[model samples]
Target: MTQDPVSIEPLCLDEGHALGEFYPLKQQAQAEDFPADPAACRKDFLGQILHPRPGNSVLAWGARMGGRPVGLCAVGVPEAGRRWTADVVHFVVHPDVRRTGIGSRLLATATGHLAGLGVQKMTAFTSGPADGAGAGDAFAEATGAARILRYQRLSLRIGPTRLATDGDTGAGCELLHWRDDVPAEYRAAFAAMSSRLAAEEAARSGSDQVPEDFDEDKVQELYAVLRAWGYRTYLTAVRHRETGLLVGYSALGMADSHQRHASQWDTIVLPSHRGRGLGVVLKRANLSWTVEHEPELATVTTWNAIGNPAMLHVNESFGFRLDQSGARREWTL
Candidate 1:
């Protein structure tokens, strides 16, 4: 006997067990070699929903088969603004119902909810599954989202040599590491570079929803908070050598420094500063600094957009390979 298809609708957060059942699917979709312990996935999904932040959100929607959740999708809006965008964050369907259009309906409906709230753009990440790569690629095609960024991951084995290349100096640019004490002359230059880097990534300095007094002081405060929380990997690169003008920078990070995997994030080189090979120079400089200062480090990871061949070339020279690839998709109102 054939069973009828299930219907879709938003499930209130208060709708308990039915919503909780979706964690397994989220885990399988999210991680490779995911923990078998039920508590791991359960804690993660709920923890984010409960994280205290002004615009944090979690919306779960699904359809049931035989009174059980046979398909599901989730969206999270951790922040929002006019010229800003929200992330699809998480979306998945039960394996049994995949390829049945159930996931599409769930995503379409959730995107509608975001649009109704005045969202202008949306994003979701895609890293190839442990087994295959089609899931995120196919979904983005069906939706209206265009891929805006690309990331590639790489690995480093022991005794590997560092990547070096010819540096460009015709642009009056060179890379320098920020010292324990920032030079007085470079404060304004550092600020300008930070502003450009964030702008290039479409991150606004602040939104109207945030207070007017929010400034760089607040930023330093947040960094201080991160420092207190043990998330600190203090690193900043500047072009102070070339007439004291700053052109490129990279922020070093680590999930758990005690672990083998450290990471590089928030890397940027000015548009006019591009093609000079300053990126590679800066990275090598940072790498040398890290190896000398922190000998315990084993491997470093970085992501490059699948389409960003330029940065990929620079990173590849240093042995960075695909650690993760997230497919980003969206729907416009």
Candidate 2:
């Protein structure tokens, strides 16, 4: 008997039927590192396919053998300014098919597609236990992707803690909290602060990439996309009482009311505001607010680059335990 040849094809997003075929492959691929939550995963899959973020688009392909999917790949490309860059958002081959060429073929297809679009760089991530290596790392290495950065994934169980203690936000600063949307009065300041932080991070990473021009309109569009993706966002920011400027902010997002886990999005303090404990203040405020609003939420997960010790310290202070160590790899095309 001869094995059936593997066939790779683009996923049909025009209808929901393809999900039945694609979901199983996703589950099998992530079973070891990330257990599947049927409802949540379905929502996320459909949301990204149907209502992607503004200025971004996703392309997915499924590899099938014997008329069933055995591997999958999804890539995301920014539709506008960052056309030269793309992300290999999801790449997996069924465990049973490991060591076979299916994974390589899927990656080759993705790389070809990206090259056709003039993408000059592509990045992917692999995650596993903090102390052990995983299949993803091995695959990336075998494919000759350069490991550019290491990240620590941390999780915090929601509970009563000292993080809720009121802290001084400087003598002339005040804290503001909001759910779902940024208040009209703070929109401009929030956009400016976010843009600045993005630029700083890009520079710190030794990338010459320019940060997106995040204006008030762009900020509103971001929140709208998050809403479409089934997330309820919680934000906390510190503002100068006299200047009326936002000095720092932190954000947490929960997928739905039933989700027991939430994701910590970003925590940033202006350079001038550093050492004033504003990062701690912003994160604590957001975490406390999220806990209050999300009655069933159990844990919050966050990722930080290993070199960012300051942010790691703040998370550790709030009792976030190490969950996984991961590598971010990149390929130049």
Candidate 3:
């Protein structure tokens, strides 16, 4: 018997909301504890594009298994990260639609557009830690993409009490930390910093990673989207006394933005300023802002490579405990 073909089209605002339904389902199926509200799904989807770090476009697509939306895949190519490479930002299909080729179809559409944009390669990330089978292994295996690195997500509890920031001074050194917006001037700086990130990523690389190689203009687009998301929350930077360069910077915001619990988005320090501990300084400043301003914040989470001890130490000082309790398996293509 012949089955109807799945239609495909470029994503637009109204149509894209369809992708929201898949969020909780994917979460539930993967973790068994995902929340039931579809509204949370919409908030997360809209937030990614609207604020803090908007990077890619999406699609509203699915198949009719007896005439219902049963699959969804969002292919996003960040405007700047990983250069022109595209990424499988989100991909999930109803278990009922599992064998119908819906996943592949979505992959094809997303990759095609990205390739058109001059993206040479594509990278994807999805993980699972299901009951001791190497968490993300199942999904990673299904996709056929090789798993190069597995990032561990961790969190630090911000105690109910306030912390100190009196030690820091804003003399010639401007501590540019603001969440609601990124200074218009930093948009250009972010792009430069983004372009420069390619080399920086290369220096730390031990596995294949995308977005790590993003360029400057892509960074600018991301900043624009982040500003829209009300995530313009944690953009912190330190300037040089003589050169006035944005020598070190950190971006902090929430992952589940509606959840109020903050998380580290991105942070970097110029090789020129590495010895100065500005990376920690930049991050600490942001944490101070969060604890001082948002008392409702519960936990602030971040992930770091197991091998990256320097940062792990900084997180420890701030009380971020290793999320040894949580892990995810990954699938890549």
Candidate 4:
């Protein structure tokens, strides 16, 4: 018997039911390496689809065989700089449908749409070894994309203990802690510091991509999206006491009080503030705050580029263990 023809359709906010159908395929795709929390995963999936970050747009497509969703792909285009690039946010094909043309067709459709928008390149992330023969790795290679970077996922088990609070954070720097919003007095400096971090990362990666200039409005938009997904942001920043400028910051995010897992977001220290052990100070302070606030939290996970040894050392000192490996692949259009 001949197999039924697969159909690719656009997934939009109005089609919530159809979008939800992709959850099963998502679960199956990640089952081997990353067992997901059903409730949290579904909530996060729907939340991202329903409420995207401000100044960004997402395009999703679903593949159906005889009216059942068998494959899914979603791409994101930023509103500001880097308009020539796009991110392949999520891409998966059901196991039963392996080797079928569905995956390729879905990608082609996405690329065609993006090409029309004048996007010159696209990037994707795969959750496996860059050299391994996993399905995700194989697919990326088959698509002629280069594995540009590799990252290690680390997790730290939390306990009922208080982390050390005192540390050398430079001669005249003071630490500030806050939940959810940046205080009014620090908003402008915080935005500038974030923008600087973005530029440094892009330059370090040898990419000419332009960084987004963040402001008060952009920060609020980020918080709004996090709130829509039922997440709380915990931040720890170091301010130069005499200069009254933010020199470093670290942030952690929790989905809700009920979830036992949280994720470390970002940790950045200004170039001038390096070699003072500020990274350790910022991370320890933030983790202490996270543990104190969330009594049920068990594990906190983070991802670091394999090249960043300094941050890795800090995480290792905190007892974080390796969980898995992943790679980022980029394709030029």
Candidate 5:
């Protein structure tokens, strides 16, 4: 018996709506533990596809059956740096169509598209244990990809004293926190710290990640997009009082309407200021701020590299438990 051949095609702004529609169906079929709101997910997909920020390009491919999308594979390439690498954002296939070779076709086509752009390396992340019988693990194994790094997604239940801790001040430094926007006075220093951390992270991970292109204008632009997408950002930082430099930083991001979950993003302390317990202080401040402003916020999720014990220790103190785990897989061509 012969089955219909899967048709994989590139998607652009014209098929953006189709990609949005396929996402919810795919999530519902695959991710049973954490179901996504179709409307919200669709809205976010459309927003990113139709009006992406500058210096970012998307390459998306859809698997079609009977003229309807049944699978999706998408990746993004930064315009400014790391032109040789692509970030695989989503790779999903409808449940009913599993083990039917559709995913392989979609992946092949997506990779072909990336190859046309001269991309030399590809990176992907999925949510499951490496040894587990998860779809992501299966896909990685079948594709000859190597799991380079392991990470854990931890969730902290927000309650009285959930994220509160005593303030530990460093010599000649003070802490500052803000919501929604980075203050003008500290934007430059903030960008510098963030850029260094990004570059260092790439080096440690053995990826060709170029330095982060962060500036005051870039920070402002990010805040604008967050506002447009209905997200509130809380930022905490420690600055040297004498030098007026940002030595440590952390952030919490919560959706405006979805008050149940917040994401903890980008915590870093400068190498020169590493021993001051600044990581814990910055994280605590941001978590406290999120709880105060978003009263309905129940759980905050943060991702940590398995090798980073310092940050992990701080998160443990805040009572964050492992909610999900995954391995970062990369392939070089």
Candidate 6:
């Protein structure tokens, strides 16, 4: 007997409860058994609906089979620079009905919303092959999307031991720390170094990431979003003693809802100051602090492009192990 096809409908903040039933799909789609924090998920969803990334708007839709929600698609359109790109951040369907057209239906609906918003390019990510075939890899193949680049997700367990104790800031370098926002005096230099780091990262991985023109105002805007969403950010910045300029920085962020998990966001050092071991110093300082302040934190996850060996070496030295890998994929509208 043939069954009826799933119906796709737009989802709003008020109807987000219906999408909660499919939360298990998150673990199924990823290679690792990520800790399930329903509270965190709900908080994040509501926050994005209310206050999206500094300059971005989101569109979400749910798929229903026999009048019951079974899948979801979420797309974010940039209101600022990367205007042409729409990120399909989350797309998941229950395993039982995965190949039964639910995913395709949800994807079509997501792309439709992006098209209506004048989005020219679409970007999405899928977990790398776990077993013989990972869900993300299969889905991309089925949808004719191009696999762009692969990144390694590494994690380190926080134990009672300090990984790196040598905090020596070699010749002309000094270390500074921040909790939420870059200080007034360091904003300009931080933004310049950050922008340069972003451009270099994008070029190394062949990604379509646009180098942001960060200024004091832009930095403030991002900090505002983090505060509104209940995120706590810990940062380590290295300043040049002679020039009184910031040459490198690293950031670790954790959300109140997900206390057990922390993300190692960005670690960047200016080209001229690269060989002085600033990356190691920044990472060590932040890790030491995180282990002290965030006792509940058991895991720190970080991603590095396959082409980035220097950072990979730093992470490996800190006992970080490869948990899973992911591929960035894209489609042209």
Count of clashing pairs, candidate 4:
0
Clashes of each: 18, 0, 28, 0, 0, 0
Q: What is the C-alpha lDDT of each candidate?
A: 0.57, 0.79, 0.56, 0.79, 0.74, 0.74
**What lDDT would candidate 6 get against the real structure?**
0.74
Candidate 6 Cα errors over 4 Å, as ranges: 1-5, 14-40, 80-82, 129-133, 163-166, 207-209
Candidate 1 TM-score, C-alpha based: 0.62
Model 1 agreement with the true structure over 186-274: per-residue lDDT tens digits = 55555566666545444321222221222344445434444433443635565745466677776665432234445676566777678
Which runs in model 3 stand beyond 4 Å of their true positions? 1-17, 20-41, 46-60, 77-84, 95-120, 130-136, 166-174, 206-220, 229-232, 255-257, 324-333
The better candidate by lDDT, 3 or 5, is: 5
Error of 1 at 104 (Å): 2.5
For residues 120-166, write the lDDT of model 6, one tens digit per residue.
Answer: 77888776532344676778877888777777888877776654473
Give the candidates in order of lDDT, highest first.
2, 4, 5, 6, 1, 3
Displacement of residue 72 (Cα, Å) in model 4 is 1.3
| Residue range 1-333, candidate 3, lDDT tens digits | 775556654445463355454555565544432222112334555554323244455434444444445555555555655445455545566654466777667766666666666676666655433233332255456656555445556677666442565225245566777665556666566656665655554445444443344445556566556555545366777877666677766777654444556768667766766655666677777777766667677677676655556677767766776553222222222
Q: Mind giving the per-residue lDDT tens digits that candidate 5 earns over 172-216?
A: 888888989898888888888878877766665755556566888
259-305: candidate 4 lDDT, tens digit per residue: 68889988998888887789988988888887778777788888888
**Winner by TM-score:** 2
Query: Estimated TM-score per prediction?
Result: 0.62, 0.91, 0.73, 0.90, 0.88, 0.87
Expressed as tens digits, the lDDT of each residue in 23-134 for candidate 2 is 6666666665566322335555556655666677888888999987888888878886578777776687888777889999998888888888888878887987778877
Root-mean-square deviation of candidate 1: 7.1
Residue 195 of model 1 has an lDDT of 65
Candidate that beats the other on lDDT, 1 or 2, i.e. the better one? 2
TM-score of 6: 0.87
